[model samples]
Target chain A: MKQRTRFSRTVVGGAALSLMLSLSGCGAGSDAADGDTIHVLVYGDAANKVEKELVATFNETSKVKAVLDTIPGADYQAKLQTIINSKQAPDVFFNWGGGSIKPFVDAGLLLPLDPFIAKDPGLKAKFLPSVFNSAVVDGTSYGIPMRGTQPVLLFNNGKVLKDAGVEPPETWGDLLAAVEALKADGVTPIALGGGDRWPTLMWFEYLYDRIAGPELFRKALDGDREAWASPDSRKALGKIKELVDAGAFGTNYDSVKFTDQGSPTLLATGKAAFELMGSWEYSTQQDAHPDFAKSDLGYSAFPSVEGGKGDRANLVGNTNNFYSVLKKTKHPQAVAEFLKLMYSDQFVKAQLGIGNLPTTTNTERFLDTAASPEFAKFQYDMVKAAPAFQLSWDQAYPQSAATPMYQALQQFFNGSMDEDAFIEAMRALPAS
Target chain B: MTRTATPSAADGTFDKADSPGIGAGRPGFLWAAPAAVFFALFAIVPLIMVAVLSFARWDGLSSPEFAGLDNWKLLFDDPVMIKSLWLSVLLTVLGVLVQTPLSILLGVWAAGHQRNRAVLSAIYFVPMLLSVAAVSVLWRAVLDPNFGVPAQATWLFGDGNLFGTQAGAIGVLVFVSTWQFTPLHTLIYQGAARAVPQVLYQAAQIDGAGTVRQFVHITLPQLRNSIITSMILMVVGGLTTFDTVLILTQGGPGSDTTISAYYMYQKAFKSFDYGSASAIALLLVLVSTLISLIVVRLSGYDKMRSTMEGL
Candidate 1:
C-alpha cells in the first residue's frame, strides 16, 4: 500500500508540473519594463509622416524610443484584425469611431477611455460633440478621433469645364446638364469606379440621405422602418440609374479596377472631365501628377435635389479613422499617455501643416492662414455652415446588410440590374 | 512432432513464475499511449470541438447556444450557398476533364527528348512556381479590360473588351487556372511515364502498332495510376479555388464567379456569420469526402493494385 501510494503521488506530481509548464507557456508575459519604447499603428502616407515627426519630438523630449507601424488605408483593418485575433494586438492601433469599432468592443478588446478623458481637461473640451459622440458606445468611449473627413465633390480642372462651356453644378438639374455637356465634348462625364462595390455604394447612400434626410435613413438602417417601399429611396435609386443611363461612366466600367480607375492618370491626362470623390483625392492627385495645381482643383458639396428635403450642405461622413488602446494591453496608462501626446497642440499643428483635418476643435487655431489657403477656407466654411452631418450609410449599417447592399449597388451601376430590383434585394437581406 | 521436441525445453528450461509476464497475453498499453495522446490532442479533440460547435450557435467570441438544425437548414435554403456549391462542382469537373489530357500529352512529348527537355520542362513549370497571389495579380492584369494585353489585342482587332461579359470573365478565369495548374500535372505525369519500360514500346512496335496506338495501349495503361492521382488532386484544388476569382472579379457582376470557399469566407469574415459558415464548411467536407470515395472506386485503383501484386 505504501509503495502504491508513492507511485500515485509521483504520477500526480508529474501531471501537475506538466500542467503548470503548459499554462505558463500559454500566457508568457512580455518584458517591456524599459519604459523607453512606444509602439503606434497609423494609416496613410501623410499621417505616417506626421506621426514620425511627433514621435521624434516625443523621443527627444521624454528620452524614450517611439516606433510607428504604418499600414495602408485599404489593408489596415484586415491586418489589425489578424493581430487582434492572434491575441497579440498592438499597444496602439487605428480604430474607426462608430459601429466599425463595435466588433472589437464586443470582443472585450478595446480599453474604455472614460477615466482617461476625466483626468485630461484638454481632451474633454477640445473634441467636438459630434466627434466625441462617435467614440461612445454603451456610455463608454473606446477611441479618440484623430482626423475627420466630410464628403465633398472633387472635380477636375476649370479648363476642362470652360472648354465644355459648363458651370459648377449648384442643383441636381445643373449636375445632369453638366454631365450632358461634358459628354457632348467627348469626355467621360463621371470617373466612377463601380468595380469596387464600396465606391459605387457611396453614390447610393448620398442620394438616399439627400432624399430621405438623416432621421429616416437612420431608422431604415436600424431596421425599425422599411427602406425598399419609400418613395425617397426609389427616387434616389432612380437618380443613380439616370446617371448610369446618361453615359456618365466610361465604357467597360464594370471590368475596371478601382485603383486604375480612381487614380488621377485619366483625369490628369484630360480623358475624363469630373470625378465625384472625397477630399483625400486632393493630396492623392497632387502626388500622382506633379503639374497639378491647387488652383486647378475644385471642391463643392453634392448639389441639392430641386424638391428634395435634404439640403446641399448636409455633410455625409464621420470623424472616423482614429487609434484606441487595447484592453488586453499590459500598459494601459502608458497607452493613454501616448494618445494624449498624439493629440497635443504640437502634434495638431504638425498634422494641420501636413493638410490633415484634425478632430480637436482647438486645432483650427494652429492652422497657418498663409500656408494652406484652401484648407483655411474649408475650415471657415465648415464652422459657418452648421451643416447636418449624416453618418456613412455602409458604416452605420451592420456588416451583414452593408456588404450585400454595396455589392447590389455595384451590380446596379454595372447595368446588370435596375434600381427597384436593387432596393428590393437590399430589403430582402437576411437580418441576424 | 511438437510434443517430441517440446520447443521451450529444447531451447532452455521454462520457468512457471515468469510465464504470466511473458508473451502469453496481449501487448503492453504503453506502446499505443503516445499515439493515442497525439491523436487526442491534434485530431480527435478538435474534431469533437468542431462537431459540438456545429450543432450550436457561436460568433467565435461569444457564448454558444444550442442551435440544433437551424444552421444546417439555412445551408440548404441559402441561394448563394447553393449556387456556390454548384459552381465548385462545375469547376472541379472542368479542371479534371480539360487539364488532365493536356498534361498527359505534354508529359509524353517531353519524356524522351533529352536535348531540349530541360529547357522545355522549365518553361512549362514556370506558372506553378509563382505564388497564388502573384499568379492571381498577374492574370488579373492580363485579363483587365482597360489595360490588359487581351483588351489591347481585342481593340486592335475591333472586337472591343474581353472582360465586359460574364462568359468572357469566366473564360479568362478557366484559361488562367488551366494554364497555371497544367504544369504541375505535367511534371507528375512525366515522372510516371518515364518509369514505364522501353521494352513494352518495342513489343507494341513488333505487333505493328504506331506511336499513337502504342501510347494508347501500353503507355496509358501503365500511367493510369498517375493520371488518376493528378485528376483527384486537381479536382480537390478546383473545389476550393478562391484567390484568382477574388483578385479578378471579387464575385462582382452579382456574384457571378463566387465559389464555395469564397462564399464561406465572405460569410464568416465579411458578413460575420460564423454559424452559417461552419454549417457550410461541414457540408463541404461531407461532399468532398463522398466524391473522393466515388472517384477512388471509379478509377479502379484497388483492382489495379491487386493486379500489380499478382503480377
Candidate 2:
C-alpha cells in the first residue's frame, strides 16, 4: 500500500511536471510579444529583405518596436494556420488574401481593418481596388496589400518560338498552332510543372474564366454543384483534354516541377517553347538564367478563347500578399502605422527594384525604377485593364478543398479520371 | 520530422522492455522515474491528446468540438483513406522483400576479413549517415526527368518519366528507400554474422561444404535474432514513410503513392482537418504496432532466447 501510494504520488507529480512543461510551451508566445514589441510574421523568401527593411523603418519613430518573425519555405502556411489563434499569434502577419484568410475571419481571430481605413482613407485608396478587394471577407476589410500582385502570364522562349516559326500566341487557336509547331520542331510544346499540382491548376483557372466568364467558378465556389456540371465547365475540361492528347506538354510533365527549376530550365535551354507562369517568372529567370531572360524571355496574357463569355483581359494568379492584423493585438495603432508603410514611396521603390509589381497607384511613377521596366509595364497595364482577376483555384477555395481539388485536377490531367469524374470531384469539395 | 519518427514511439517502448533486465544491480522504479516521466511527457501525453482529438472535429483555427465517432466513420467511408492504407502496406512489404536478401548478402560478404572489404564496408555505410530528408532530396535531384541522371541515361530511364506513372513512382520510392536504408540492416547482419561461432564454419568446411552452403546452413540460423530486430525496424520505418513521398512524389501522379502517413499530413496541413488527420495518425500507430507485434509473435522473438548459447 505504501509503494502503491508512492507510485501514485510520483504519477501525479509527473503529470503536474508535464502539465507545467506544456503550459510553459504554450506561454512562450505571450513571452515573445511582452509589452514593447509587435511581432511581424512574414513568409521568409528573397522578399523578406524588403520586409525587414520596412520593420526597421517602422521602429525608428513608433513607440512600439516591431520585431520581425519569419517562418520560411513551404511550411509557412501550415505554421501560420497552427499559430494564428494561439497566444503566440502575431500582431500582424503575411497572407495571400482570399480563402486563405476566410477561416481566420470566420473564427473571429482577425481584426477588421475598416476602422484603420476609416482613420486613414489612404489605407484603402493608396492600393489598387482589384488587389485590395481580394482580401475583403464577406464585405469586411481584413487585409492590407503589402507585396505586389503576381498576375499569371504566358511566358515564352523567343529562340524556341522563332525556331518553330511561331509567335507568342494571342488566341486559343494560335496557341494550338504554336504547340504543333513546337512539337514538330522537336521541343516540348509547353513546359508544365505538373509535379507541383498548383501549377497544373493555372490552366483550369484561365480556361474556366475564359470559357464560362468566371461566373461558373464563382457559382461553384458559392456551393452550386450544378456549376461544375454545366456545359461551360465540360467545355473547359474538353479543351484541356484536347491539349493533353495533342502532346502539348509532352508525356512527362508530371516528372517536372517549377519549384525545383525543372520546367524553367527546359524553357531556358530551348527544349520547351512556352510556360504559363506568374509575373515572378521574370525575377526567377533573371536569377537563374539571366542570359535567356535578357535575350528571349517574352510574356503575354493567356490567349483569348474564341467566342468565350469572359473578356480577354481576365487575369488569374496570386492577386497580392497581404498584412492582416490579429483581433487580440494590443498595438493596433502601431500595426496601423506599420501597414501605412505598405503604400509608402520607399516600399514601392524597394518592391519594384526586386521586380515585384506593386499595386499602389504610385506604382506607375516607380515603374521606370523597376528591375525590368518593360516587364513591369506589361503586368501593371494588364492588371489595371483586367475586367476580372481570378485568384488561383487552390487559393480561392477554402483550405479544406485543396487536397481533393488537387487530386481531381491531377487525375483528370493524367487520364486517371474522365470529365464527369472530375466534375463530381469538384462538386464534392466542401464549399466555404 | 514527424514522418519517420512517429511509429518509433511505439517501437521504442517495446524495444526497451524487451531488452534483458534482471537481478540485484537492476535499478528500482525510483531510478526509472525520471525516464518514465520523460516518456510520459513526450510520448504518452501527446499520444493521449491525439487519441482524444481523433474523436473531435477541429480545423486548428476553431476550438475542437466532440464529434463522437464521426471522424472514424468518415475515414472508413473514404476511398482515399482505404487506398492510402494499402499503399502503406505495399511499400512496407516491398521494403522488406527487396532489402532483406541484399543486406544479408552484403552483410555476409563484409564479414570476411579481407582488407579491401573494410574499405568497401566504410563506403557502404555512407547512406546510413544521411537523414531521410537529405536522402530523398538527393535522389529527387538525381532522378529528375530532364536534367538529372535519367536525362543523361535516356535509354535506361526511358524519357526520364519515372514519376509520371504509378508503377514508375512506386519503383523509385522502393529503390530509394532500399538504397538509403539497406546499409543499416547490413551493419546489423554484419555484427550478427561475426557473432556466429567460427567452430560451426570450420566443421562445415571439414564436411566439404562450400562458402554458399556454410552461409546457408550455419550463418542463416545463427542470425535469427538480428533478423527479427532488423525486420521490426524495417516494418515501422516503411509504415511511416512521409518525407520521401513528400519530397519525391508528393503521393502523385494522382494519389498513386499516397501512403497513410503522407495522407495524414495532407489531412492535417493541406486540408486543415486535424480531427481526421489525428484519426489517420492513430490508425497508423495501431497498424504499425500490430504489424510489429505480429512479426515478433511469428518469429518467436518475444521468447528472447540466446543465440550465443549452446556453445
Candidate 3:
C-alpha cells in the first residue's frame, strides 16, 4: 500500500506552531523605555490627583515632559517589583523607602540622588532630615520625600468616648482603664482589622516602641537577634497579650478588614470606641463617613507606659512616601527637576489640600492652607516633636521578610503563637 | 475486501487511509497542531521554567544562581509546607466526599422536565456563572462577622469569627468552594443522568423496583463514567484552590487556612521566595497528576467500555 505524501500538511503545521510561538512572545513583551517623557509611577488612590497635577505642573516648563503612571495601592509593590528590571521600569517611582527600596538598591537599579543634592542643596535641605534619611541605603541618598509622613496615632469616635465617659488613653494604665469602660458600655474598645494583618502589626510597632524604645527595634532591624528576645520585647508582647485578653479588640476582629472599611465603619457607627491607626485614618474617615469625620473624629498619640524606657514623644509608622529614581533613566536632569516639584510650595499645598501632611520644611508654612488646618497641625507638630520615629516593622525589613513577619504578627494577636514563637519568627527574619 | 491494516502518516499519527471510506473524511495532523502549539507555549513552557526555577535561588530580581536541591530540602523540612500538603489533601478529600453525593442527587432531581425543577436548576447554576474571585468577594462581604448575614443571624454564627480559628477558616474555605462549584459538577451528573436510557427505569418499575432501587440498580451504574470525570475535576480543583482561600480567609488568622496553593503564592509574591514557591508548585503538579492517575486506574476508567454497548 502506497502512502500519500503529507509534506504540505507538516509545513502548514510548523507554520501555525511558529505563528502562535511569535504571538505568545508578543504577550510576554513590554513597551520599550525610549519615550521623551519621564514616567513617574505612583501608588494610585485618591492621591493620584495630586501626582497628576504635579506631573502637569512639571511639564509646563521642562523640556523633557513628565508622564504620571499609577498602579493601584494594593498592587503597587508586587507590580513594581515585576516591572522594575524590565524595559517597562519607570524613570522615577513612588516607594515607602527603607527596605522597600533596599532590594532595588542592592540590585543597583536605583539612582542615588546625591548628584542632584550636590547641584541643588534645597532638594535635600527642603524635606525633613529624618524623612529624607529613610531612603538613604548605606549612607548614599537614593530617594526624595514626595508625599507625607504617617505616624501611628490613637484615633477615636468622640461620641462613643463621650457616651462611655472614656478619654483617649494617655498612659498604658489609662488605656487599660478605657478598654474596661468601653467594654462595659458595649462598644468594642479597639477596632482592629486583624484580617488585613498589617493593622495588627501597627499594634506591635507602637507597643514595642513604647515599652523598649525605638533603639531595640532599630537594633533588631539591623540584624541583632538578641533584640527580639530582650526583656523589653517580652514586656511589649506581655502588654499586647494583656490588652487582647481584656478584650480590647473584641471577638470578631479577625473577620474585619481595614481595606473594606470594616474596622473604620465600626468606629463610625459607634460600635467601636477606638482604632489605633496611621495618620491616613483621618483621610479614610473623612472619605467614608463625612459626618463622623466632621464632628466626632478625634486623634491622639499612642498612650505611654508609665515605667517604659521609651519616651512618650517617640513615634512609629511610615516616616513618609518617597520618589526613588531608576539608574537607567536617560533624563536624570528632567527627573531631578520633577523631584524638585516634590518640595515645591505647589506640591505642599496640593498635598495639604488632600489631607496628606507633607514632610517638607515648608509644610509648616502651608499648614494653615491645609484641608483641616487643625488636623494638619496635629500631625505636623507630632512629627516635628518626635524624638525618634521608627518606620513600621514590615517596611523596615526586606521584602522577603514581610509574609513570615505578618504571619507572626497575626498568629501572636490571634493566640495561635505564644510570645516565644513570635520572638523566634521575628529573629528569623532577613534583617539586611 | 476489508483490510484491517492502519495507514499512518510519516509521523505515525495512525491514519485511517487504508480503512474503507473513513480515511477520506479524516482531517490531517494540522487540525490539532494549533492547540498543541498553544498548550506548549502557555502551559508546557512555563511549567518547564518553574521546574528550572525550583532548583535556583532567584527572587524575581537579579540573575538566578543554581542552589541545587536547597529549595526542595527546605520544603521537606518546613512544618508549614508539610501542614499545607496535608491541608490540600484533606480539603480535596472533603470536597469529593461532600460534593459527589450532593451533586448526584441534585443532578438526578434536575433531570426532570418539570418547570420548577428547571427554574431551580438555573438558580443553582448562578454561582457557577460568577468568576471565582467575584464569588469569593461576594461571599466575604456577605459573611463578614460584623455587617454581614452572620451579625443578623447570631444563633447561626456564634460570635461570627469564622476566620478566627483553624477549624473555622477551613470550614469557610470548604463551604465557599462547595457553594461555588457544586453546580458545575451537578451539571456534569445531570447530563450523564439524562443519557441513562429511560427503558432501564421502565424495566425497573415493571420489576416492581422503587425509586430508590431504580436509582441504585440502574441510574447509578450508568453514571459510572461521569462520576470519575467529575471526581477528577473536583480533586484537581480542590488541590489548586487559591482564590477562595485568598479572598475569604487570606490563609489567615495566622496561617490557619494556609493550603499548599495559597502557601506557594505567599512564598512567591508575599515573601518573594521564588525558589521555594516554584518547588511547591512542582510538588503540587506531581501530586495532582499522581492522584488523577491513581483514580483513573482504580475506577478502570481507561478500559473504554461503553455503558450502552449491550443495548
Candidate 4:
C-alpha cells in the first residue's frame, strides 16, 4: 500500500510539473512590432475584405505599411478596451464615432484630428459636415469617417405587402391600419429584432423623433433628466405600447435577433411584412437571399407621426464607421495618408459597390454607379434634406449608460416598466 | 555535547537509517510549494485584487480612483443587481432540486445495465460534450416561434409561444441546463456507485434487501460525498450562469432570465464599471462560499470526516 501510494504521488507530481510547463508555454506573446508597419484594427465582418484590400493598396507605395487587424463584431469593444491600454494598442482603430469613442477620448488615449484637418483642409471639407461631426467631442474632431453613412430605413418585403394587398405605410396612421390589415391577412406587421434589445431601440428612436422632435432627445443627451419625463416622451412611450398591444411586432419579437439573422430571415421568407433596420440590411439581405433582395426588397423613410414636431425626412442611425488614431501611434503621417484615402474617388466607388452610401462630397457622383442606384439616391436625398438626424440613443449616451438605457427601453416596451419608472431609470443614468 | 533527537526520529519508528535522505519520514513541504505558488498567483492574487477593486471607481480606460463604499452603496440600491441575485439563487436552488435525483436515478440505471452501459452512457453524455454556445444556439433555433418545434406544435395546438414568456424562458433555461449537465452528475454518481464494494451489496442482498432498499441504505450512504460535491458544483454554476443565458435570452424578455454573472459581465464590459463589477464578483463569491459551507455542514460532511478519521 505504501509503495503504491508513493508511485501515485510521483505520477501526480510528474503530471503537475508537465501541466505547469505546458501552461507557461500557453502565455500568448505580443504581436511582433514592425518598425515600418502601422496596425489598423477594425470590427471584423463581411466588410473586412474591403479593409484588407485598402491596406494592401496603401502598403504598395507607403513608407509605413498598414496592417489590418480585426476583432469580431460582438467582442470588438471589450477586446479594444483590454488592448488599448497595453503595448499592443493599434495605431489606428475603427469606432462608431460618438459615445463609442468618448471614453477613450476622455482618457486621453485618442489623438485629436484638428491638427491633421488643419494640415489638409480637404480632409475636413470632403466629408459631410453632419456625419463628420459625430466623431467630434466637445468641438474637437478625433476621428475620420472611414465608411458610409448608415441611416435607419423602413425595409419592407414587396411580395409580403402585395400579398396582403397593402401599400407600405406613408404615415403613422397608415402604419396602424396596415398592421390591422396584415394581421387580418395572417402575417406579422413588423419583424423586430427585440432579442438584441438595440433593435427594439429603433422604434423608440423614430417615434420620439416624430412625436416630440429632435430637441427632446438633444436635451436628454445633454443630461436634462426632465426631457425623459415630459408629456411628449410619455406620449411616445404610449404609442410604442399601443403598437405592441396591436401585435404590430408580433409576440415573438423578444426572442429574435438581427445579429443572428432571425428577424431578417422572417422578412426575407415573407413570414413578416416589414423590418425597420439600417441601410446595411440591403447588403445583408442581398447576401443571404439574392433572389428575394433583387425582386422583393423595398426601402423607405419611417412613416411620419400625425401632429408630430419633427421633420418627415428626419433620419436616425450611425453616421459612419470612423478611424481614430491612438495617441501612442508610431506612424501619424501614415495614418494621415490613410484618412485621406477615405475621401478619394476609389474609396467612394468601392463603398458604393458594397451598397454603402458614403457621406463623402464625391459620393453623389458615384451613386449612379452603385450596386442599387435607386436605394443609394433615396438615402442620400433623405440625409441631405433632413432637418435633424438624431443619433441612436445608445450611441449618443456614454458607454456606461448603454446597458441601462437599453434595459429601460426594453422594459418599457415589454410592459415591465411604466412611463414613470422608465423616466426614473433614465434620470438615474450615470452622468459621466 | 548533549545529543537531542526529535520524538519521531528517536522512536526508531521510521527506520531513518534505511529511509532515503530526501523526504525521509517527513512531510514534503517543498513538493507542495509549486502548487501553493500556483494557487497564490492565479486564485489568491485575483481574489485579493477583486476585493481591492470593489472599493475603487474604475471605467476600464480611466485610472482607478478611490470610491469609499460607493460601489457597495450602489449595489444595495441597484434593482437590476438585486433582481439578478435573486434569480441566480432561485436558479441554483432549482438546479439542485431538479438535477440531483434525476442524475442519481439515471446513474444507477446505467450502472445496473452492465451490457448496454457504454451505449446508455454515451447517449446521456452527448449534451455534455456540446459547447455551451452550441447548446444555447441549438436550443434557440429549436424553440424559435417561426419554424421551430414550438411552431410545429401550433398546428396541433394554437400558437405555442414557449420561449416568449418569462416563465417559459426560465423553464426552458432550467430544462436545457438539466439536459446538458445531468450527464456530468450521472457520470460522477456512476463512478461513486462503482467505487462501492461488491461485498457490502452482496451482504445486503443476502439479508433479503430489495434493490430499492439496497439503494436507500447502501448506495445513498456511499454516494454522500459525490452528491454533496456535485450539488455544490451545480449550485456554483447556477450562480454564475452566463453563457447559456447570454446566448439564449441576453437577460431579455424583460430581464427575466438575467443571472448575476451575466449582470456582472454587462457591468464590467458594457458599462465599463469595473469597480462595481468587482464588487459583484466578490459578492457572488461570498454567496457561493456561504451556500457551499451550509451544504457541507447540513450534509454531515464534518460527521463523515470524523468517521473516516476514526477508520
Candidate 5:
C-alpha cells in the first residue's frame, strides 16, 4: 500500500511539474513573438469583419503581422478593463475618444500620438478637425479617428405620409403638422423605442440641444449650468410630453426590449411614418428589411425648433468610437505603421463602401455622391456651413455620472419620473 | 542521555522501552501536512483576500485604498444595493416555497408504477442540461413581444403583451427558474425515494394503509434527508441567479428583477466600482451562510444523521 501510494504521488507531482513547464514555455514563446505582432482589439460584429479584412490587407503588404481580437459590444469594456488592469493591454484597442478614454489617458495607459502626428504632415492635414479635436486631451492626441455616426430623422415610405397628405417635415411646426396629419389618418407618427433608454435619450438630447443651444448643453453637462431651473431645458421636456400626449410612441413602450422591437421593420413596412435614429440604423434597417433601399430613406437633422438658436444644421455628434494604441505595446512603431495603413486610400474606400462615415479629409471623395444625393447634399452643406457640432451628452460626461444619467433618462421615458425629476437627477449627478 | 537497557524475561522476548517517541509515534502531523497546506493556500487565502478587499476602496485598476468601513457604510445608503438584496431574498424564498413541494410531488409520481418514468425524467431534465446562455436565448425568443410563444399565446387568449409589465416579467423569470431547477431536485428526490425499503411499503399495505397513506407515512419520512438536501441546494442556487435575468431583462424597465448577484456584477464589472461590489459580495456570503444554517437546523439533519447511525 505504501509503495503504491508513493508511486501515485510521484506520478501526480510529475504531471503537475510538466503542466507548469508547458504553461511557462507557452508564455515565453508568446513573449518572443510579441515583437512581430500588433494585437488590435475592437468591438461589434460589423467592425469585426471590417477589421479582419483590414488586418489581412495590412499583413499582405506590411512587414509586421496584425492580429484582430473582436470582442462583443456588451463585453468589450469589461474585457478591456481586465486587460488594462493586468498590464496586458493589446497594441491597438477601440476607444470612445471622449470621457471614456479620459480615465485610461489619465492613468498613462494610452500612448499619446501628437509626436507621430507632427512627423506625418499628410495625416495632420488629412484628418477632420472635429475628429482630431475629439481625441485631444490636455493638448495631446491619444486616439485616431475611425468613424463618425450622427442622429438623423429617418422616415418611412410614401404610403404613411401619402395617407396623411403631408410632405417630409423640415421644421418643428411641420413635424407637429405631420403628426397631426398621421393622427387624423389613424397612424402612429413617430416610432420611438423607449425600452432602450439610449434611443429615448437621443430624442431628448435633440430637443434639449435645439431648445437650450450647444453652449448651455455643454455648460449643463459640466455642472456650470443647472438644467432643472433652465426654462429652455423645461421647454425641451415639454416637447417630450407633447409627443407622449400625441400618442407618438406605442403602448407599453417601457417593457419592450430594444433589439427585439420591430420599429425599424415598422418603418420599412410603412406601419410607422418616421423614426428618430442614428446613421447606423441605415445598415440595420437594410439588413432587416432588404426591400427598403437607401434611396427610399430621407436624411434630415431634427426639425428646427421655433424661437431657438439651434438650426437644422446644428448637429449633435461625436467621433466617440475611435482606436488608440496602448503605452505598454511591445511594437509601438509597428502599431503606428498599422494605424497608418488603416488611413490609406484603399482602406478608406473599403470603409466608405460599407456605408461607414470616415473622419478623414477624403470623406467627400469616397461618399456615395451619386447614389445618395440627399446625403451628398448634406455633406456639401456641412462643408460650406460652419454649424456648431455638439458631442454626445453621455460621452461628454464621466462614465460614473453618464451611466446613471442614462438610467434616469430611461426612468423618465418609462413614465416613472417626470422631466423636472430627470433634470434634477442630472443636476444631482456626482462630478468625476 | 541516561541510556538504560531493560532485561528480557525467561521466555527470551526482549522488553521494548516506553520512550516518548515510541509512545507518541513519529508525529502524525506530517500525514496531514500537505492537505492542510493546500486547503490553506487555495480556500483560506482567497477567503481572507476577499474579506480584506471588502473593507477597501478599489476601482479594479489602481491600487486599492484602505477606506476602513466606508464600503460597508455605503451599502446601507445605496438604494439599488438594498433593493437588489431584497429581490434576491424574495427569489430564493419563492423558489423554495414553490419548487420544493412540486419537485417532491413529481418525484413521487415518477416513482410509482409509471412505465414512462425514464422518458418523462429525460424530457424534464433537458433544460438543466442546456447552458444558461442557450436557455436564455431560447426563452428570449419564446417571450419576444412581437413573435414569441408567450406573445402569441397572449394574442390568442388575452392581452398582446405578456411581458409588458414588471410583475409579468418577474413571473416569467420565476417560472423559468423553477422549471429549469425542478427537474434536478426531482431527480434527486426520485433517487432518494427509490432507496426507501420496499419492506416498509409491504408492511404498510398489510396494515390496510392506502397508497396515499404509504406515501405520507412511510415514503416521506424516508425521503426527509433528500428533501432537505435538495431544498438547500435550490435556495443557494436561487440566491445567486444572474445569467437568465441578465440575458432577459438586464435589470430593466426600472431595475425590476435586479438580484444581488447581477447588482454585484454591474457594479464590479460594468461600472468598475469594485469596493462596493466586494462589500455586497461579503454581505451575500453572510446572508447565505445564516440562511443555510437556519435551514439545516430546521430540517433536523443532525437528528436524521443520529437516527441513521443508530439504525
Candidate 6:
C-alpha cells in the first residue's frame, strides 16, 4: 500500500510538471515598450529579411530606435489578436488592410493616419489608389501600404495548353472551351487547392467581380444583405456549379492544398493544364521547378464574363501588406517616420529586388531592376490598367465571418448546398 | 444533545473526535488543501470560466458582452454542430469497441510468447511512440487519392476516391486512430496479463481447455481493471480528437468528418467566436462527463473498488 501510494504520487507529480512545462511554452509577450525603443511586429517569412534590414536602417539616426519582432506567418494573425489588447501590443504592426484590420479599427485600437497624410500629402498620393484604399475604414486611413499588390491571375502551363490545342483564355466562353479541350486531352482542366479553402475562394472572387461588378462586393462589405441575394450573385454561383459539373477542377481537389504545393505540383508535372493563383506563384514555381518556370510558365488576366456589368480590366486579390499604428502607442511620430520609408525610392528598389511589385507611383521606373523584369512589368501593368480591384472576400470580411463564408463556398462547389443556401449562408455571416 | 452512545454536539461527530490519527481534525483540512487548490486551479476554475463564457458574446479580441442564450439558439439550428456532435459520439463508440478487443488479443498473445515477447512488444508499441502529427502526415501521403499507396492498390479493382466520401473519411479516421492507439492499450493489457499467475493457465491446460477457452475464462476476468481503464482513456481521447482529423481531412470534403472539438477549434481560432466556442466546449465537457460516468457505472468500478478492499 505504501509503495502504491508513492508510485501514484510520482505519477501525479510528473503529470503536473509536464502540464506546467506545456503551459510555459505559451507566449508571454515581450516588453519592447519600456525605453525609447518602438516595437515593430511583422509576419515572419521570406519577406522578414527585408523588414529586418529596413528596421536597422531606421534605427541608425533616429531619436527613438525601432525594434523588430516577427511571428511565423501561419500563426501571426492569431498571435496578434491575443497580444493586441495587452500592454505588449506593438506600436507599429504588419496587416492586410481590408477586414483584417477592421476589428481593430472598430475597437478604436488603431490610430487613424489622416493627420499624417495631412502633414505630407505625398504620403497618400505616392502609392496606388486601390492599394492605399484597402486599409481605409470609414473614410479614415488606418495603415500605409508596405508591400506589393498580389493579383490572382490565370497561371497556365504553356506546354500542356499547347498539347491541348488551346490559347490562354481571354473570355469566359474561351475558358469553357479550353476546359473541354483540356479534359478531352486527358488533363485535369485546372489544379485547384480546394483543401486550403482560400485557393477555392479566388474563383468566386473573380467570378463575382467579372459577372456582377465590384459594387456588389462593396455593397456586401457594407452589410447590404440584398447584395448577396441579387441575380449577379446567383449567376456567379451558377457559373461555379457549371465548372464543377464539367470537372474543370477535376475530382479530389478538396484533398489537395496549396500550402503543401499539391496543386502546384500537379500543374508543373502536366497532370493539370491551368491554375489560378497569385503573382507569388511565379517565385514559387521558380524556386521549386526552375526549368518549368523558365520555359513553360504562362500567366493571363481572369477571363471577362460575357455580357457582365463589371469591367474586363477589373482585378481581384490582396492589395498589399500594410503597417498600421496602434492608438495607444507612445511613439506615433517615430512610427510615422518609419512608415515614410515604405514609399522611399530605396524601399521601392529593395521590394522589387525581392520579386515584390511595389504599388508606389515611382515603382514603374524601378520595374526594370526587379528580379524578374517581365513578371514584374506584367503584374504592374495589369494593376495600373485595372479600373477596379476587388479585395479577396475572405480578407474583405471580418475574421469572424471567414469560416462560414468558406464553408458556404465549399458546400456550393461540392454540390451539397444550392445557390439560395449559399446566399443564405452569406447573409448569416457575422456583420463586419 | 444525546450522549448515550454518540458524542455531544460540542464534542463534534463521534468518529472524528474519537480518532487520534494525524488527519482527523485540523491536519486533515491542511493535508487536503494543496490537492484541493490544485484541482480548483486547473480543473474547477477552467470549467467555471467555460460556463461563464458560454453565455457571453466575445470575439477573442474584444471584451465579452452578455449574449444570453443566443449561442445555444444558434447551436440548435447549426447543422455542422449537430453533425460534429454525432460524429464525435460515433468515433468514441467505434474507438472503444474496436480498440478494446484487438488490443487485448495482441496483449494476450504477446504475454504468452516467452521467446519473442520483447520483439513482439516492440513491434506492437512502435505506432504509439510516433507523434500524432507525424502519423497523420504519414497516413495522408499513404492515402492520397492520386499518388497514395491505397489509391494505387484500388486501381486493381477500379478507381475510387478514398478521402472524397464521408464514409471513406470516417473509415480512414477510425483506422488511423486504431493503428496509432492500439499499441498503448496493448501495453496496458500486457501489464495486467502478466499479473495473472502462470499456475492458473497451467491448471486450465491440465483441465484440457483450449487456448481460446483458457483466455475467455482466465485471462479476461483478470484484465477487468485494465480493460475498464483503457476504455475510459480511449473514449475520452476519441471524443476530443483534433490533430489527426485536422491534418488528414480537415473535417472536409464538406465538413463530413468534423467532430465537436474540431468545430470548437474552428469557432475559437478560425472565426474568433470565443463565446460560441466556449459554449461548444461546455457541451463537449458535459457529454464527456456523462459518457464517462455511464462507463464507470456500467463497468461496476464501484464494485471493483469494494472487491479490492475486501481482498
lDDT tens per residue, model 3, A1-432:
223337445656786778877879988776665568898899998888899998888889988998888898888888998899988888999999999999999998999889999999999998777677788888899989888799989999999999999888899999999999988988899999999988999988888888898889888877899999999999999999999999999988988999998999999999999998998898889889999999999999988998898888888889999899999999999998898998898999998888788998988987999888998898889888888888888898998898889889988887889989999989988899
DockQ-based ranking = 3, 2, 4, 6, 1, 5
Better by lDDT, candidate 2 or 1: 2
lDDT of 6 by residue, B129-182 (tens): 999999999988777656667556874413335566677778889999999999
Instruction: Give per-residue CA lDDT, model 3, range B1-311, as digits (tens).
Output: 00111222211322323343434655566665766677787799999999999999987779899999999999999888998999999999988898899999999999878778988999999999999999999888998999999999999999999888888888888888889899998998899899898998898899999989999998899998789888988988999999888888888877677899999998999778899999999999999999999998999876644577566
- Of candidates 5 and 2, the better by DockQ: 2
Q: Largest lDDT belongs to which candidate?
A: 2
What's the lDDT for all of these models? Answer: 0.69, 0.89, 0.88, 0.84, 0.71, 0.85
Off by over 4 Å in 4: A1-35, B1-27, B155-160, B197-209, B305-311
Writing each residue's lDDT as its tens digit, candidate 6 over A192-258 gives 8888888999999989998999999899889898899999989998898889999898877877778
**Which numbered prediction scores highest in DockQ against the true structure?**
3
Error of 5 at A421 (Å): 3.7
Structural similarity to truth (TM-score) of each candidate: 0.81, 0.93, 0.93, 0.91, 0.85, 0.92
Worst 10 residues of 6 chain B by lDDT: B1-10
Location of the lowest summed lDDT over 10 successive residues in candidate 1 chain A? A379-388
For candidate 4, lDDT tens digit of each residue in A1-432? 376369558856875887778688766554664799898999998777677778888888898888898999989999999889888889999998878888898899999898998999988899888788888888899988888888999999999899888898889999999999999999989998887888899999999999998899878777788888899998998899899999998876776778878888999999899999988899899889899999999988899999989887888998888999999888888899988888988888888877778888889998999998988998988887777777788887888998888888888887778889988999988654
